[model samples]
Target: MTQLSLRNQLVTVFGGSGFIGRYVVQKLAQQGARVRVAIRRPEEGLFLKPMGAVGQIDIVQANIRMPMSVQAAVKGADIVINCVGILHEGGAQKFAAVQARGAEVIALCAKEAGVKKMVHLSAIGADAASGSRYAQSKAAGEAGVRRHMPQATIIRPSVVFGPEDDFFNRFAALAAFAPALPLVDGGHTKLQPVYAGDVGAAVVQAALDDAAAGQTYELGGPKVYSMKEIMQLTLDTIHKKRLLVPVPGFALKPLAFALELQPLFAPPITRDQIELLKADNVVTEGAKGLKDLGVSQPTPVEGVIETYLYRYRRGGGKFEPRFS
Candidate 1:
């Protein structure tokens, strides 16, 4: 283990129970930091206790929507990390409220608490002028953080994947069941699928490094792949033989928009999300990414999928050799 001591330093991680948050908490805990995971419902984060030494982690109920709760969570924190985001809108959890205003609220509270460092998790496509609501909200969140803490570090990652990721696994599973999987706009859009663990480590590195202050980093994997290539990789990993059917955006976008209306139930597709897929989700032009983050080339999907996707095979395991 690296001997950089963060012992007794308090870090309040918003949405630390999430897939990416778990990895960040693990890294910080190993470094001997006292981590406080702030979630809307603290009970949901109890599983995080096992990731750290006894009494090293704390779970607190804090909804970003509420100023008082956010303020309470920021109390005694040396550093604050915001991982809160939503792909779809919900009651009281709209994009503007959670991603934009909620970020401002958290930054304000962290500043009031005299926190020394702050990190905001954003997407690679975060642009104030973006057509997608998700992209726009991410940019707004970054602006919100900068407004309160000018020295805060903002990290923008391409699609993050891991064992429990919602990206590859979801599509791979559909490939197993369905005859063909639809590729948005002929799968032309490109993406650099960085591992979730890599993103987590990058967050930790930024928090500990003074030079990273007031800077924005775009994190991506070593190589870039088209959306079609990602789907093909998923198929190969799962040992599933399937054809990728490209759907014209003009034909499918309307249906997706209608499907997103029922936010009450998890929507298969949303108009905003469909629009997002139209743009390449790779890293920015001249941003320092894995090289500066102290991480070697990020883990590729090819090596990771074989480890996790085996469970989804025909026999619920890897393919066994057949006797002649």
Candidate 2:
């Protein structure tokens, strides 16, 4: 099979300014593809221009909730990737509107615009019957995408970690100030933490490989670790000895709710997030993953976490002696 060439191809990525989306845009730019970053605010995405040569990357204002704007974003693009997703609901950004309906709108717009291929980013725990509204919304979004573009490649990734990721970075920052870290539900929930860059590479592969059409890939790292182990790893990396306290779901709901009410851009933890932690976020056994999508060796958390996490260590970890 002849692989598609991304050189000079116009690829539009919705939410291209986000944590995961930036990596996708960078990968596409590296492939010599002309990247159109569709974001809510053009100014917010202007930083992406340096990822490519002058004029190779263009930032356009787009909101998936607005069909006309989505149409404008998909117009004249050979491929489209939807990376727009939210962890929690906020004003005008509900799970249903952004993840579910927003995905459908993009898929439908791409189909109408005569796009050659499409890729959709989804989460591992997306399920219609799941208790978490976040999961249910993600499942709905996948369904909507399939309904509109049957040949679209859907990539479901487990907990993704990187320099800008919230998982490890959040806990590591917490340990700097707090003496202990709360292990929700004893932190028993297992997760296969795939690197953000690998997932981005997988998305690019799915776009270029014809066989990936109509396929679903679950991306995970080389190893799976429980939530407790993940927290311990953070402490170990930052040279901190913080207590891992086990807190049940019922006990944390009140606090989660209060946090949600705060005006912070991203609350420390939300009620829906607590519900999401109930289920394991690992890739299924024997499921297709990063290897199948051309990412031969997905990155492990320990391999790259210290690059950004060292700042949280005491005295910035500069004066501390290296501990074996």
Candidate 3:
């Protein structure tokens, strides 16, 4: 597909300061697109300014739950992207509120503003019939986008790993102090981990490629692995030898509930997250994917995890033996 030029185009990105959103913003900035990062706190997203030339990237305060804020952000923008999503609900940031309703608001506002193009970030496991609320909400968000803007592009990724990702980083952190890592449901759940950078590239391509409009792409790596294998890989990368204990999903619910009750910013695991683990989180067979969007070879977990997981290694990964 021929890539559309984004030079000098005003693009509004909701949640531009987030893990996956940052990558999208950076790529847009590189393409010379003027980025307006619509975040709840403009000060928190000020760090994104360095990704582009002076005045190339700007931040505006906007909340997805607030229609007026979303409307103000998309005004006069050539394109819009919604990257706002929550892993676990917290207070008013419920899954239905942020993922479902928040998405509807963005799409509605972008359509009202006469935005030509839009790209929405979703997950591969999104299903309306799924037992997990997170997955259900994701499906609802996709439906909302389609309902509001029929031409918008949607990209669904599975287990995105990056330098600041919570997946590998969270498990590695647990291995640092804990004696063992719990493998929910015997760790048999399958997953195809995709790199955040690759997903970001897909998002950019979906935004610029006219062929991608009104299409949904499932993004994943070249290989698939079970939950047990993922945990073992984490241990290998970080040079840790923690036990991999197989635990039933039901057994973990009590502990997950306890974690949910805590006041910590991000709990180790929540009950809702355990429900998410009940099913495999891999791309469906014959689904449109990264390769369809020009990312023929998605980066594997082994290629990127070590870049950041090294910090979790003993001695800060400075004393590794070199055998050549």
Top candidate on lDDT is 2
lDDT score at residue 291, model 2, on the 0-100 scale: 89
For candidate 2, report its TM-score: 0.96
Local error of candidate 2 at residue 50 (angstroms): 1.2
Model 3 agreement with the true structure over 195-309: per-residue lDDT tens digits: 8888888898888899999999998899999999999999999999998999998999999898888885689899888998999989999999999887888887887788788
CA shift at 294, candidate 2, in angstroms? Answer: 0.7
Tens-place lDDT digits, model 2, residues 1-324: 347999999999999999899999999999999999999999999888988999999999999989999999999999999999988888999999999999999999999999979999999999999989999999999999999999999999999888878888889888888888899999999999998999999999999999999999999999999999999999999999989999998899998898888885587788898999999998998988898889998887898888878888777844231210
Cα error, residue 236 of model 1, in Å, equals: 1.3
Runs in model 2 lying further than 4 Å from the true structure: 317-324
Clashes of each: 0, 0, 0
Q: How would you encode candidate 1's per-residue C-alpha lDDT over 153-249 as one tens digit per residue?
A: 8999999988777788787777778898888889999999998888999999888887888889999987899999998888887788888989987
User: What lDDT score goes with residue 108 in model 3?
Assistant: 96
| Cα displacement (Å) at residue 3, model 3 | 3.5
Cα TM-score per model: 0.93, 0.96, 0.96
User: Candidate 1, which segments miss by more than 4 Å at Cα?
Assistant: 1-4, 262-265, 317-324
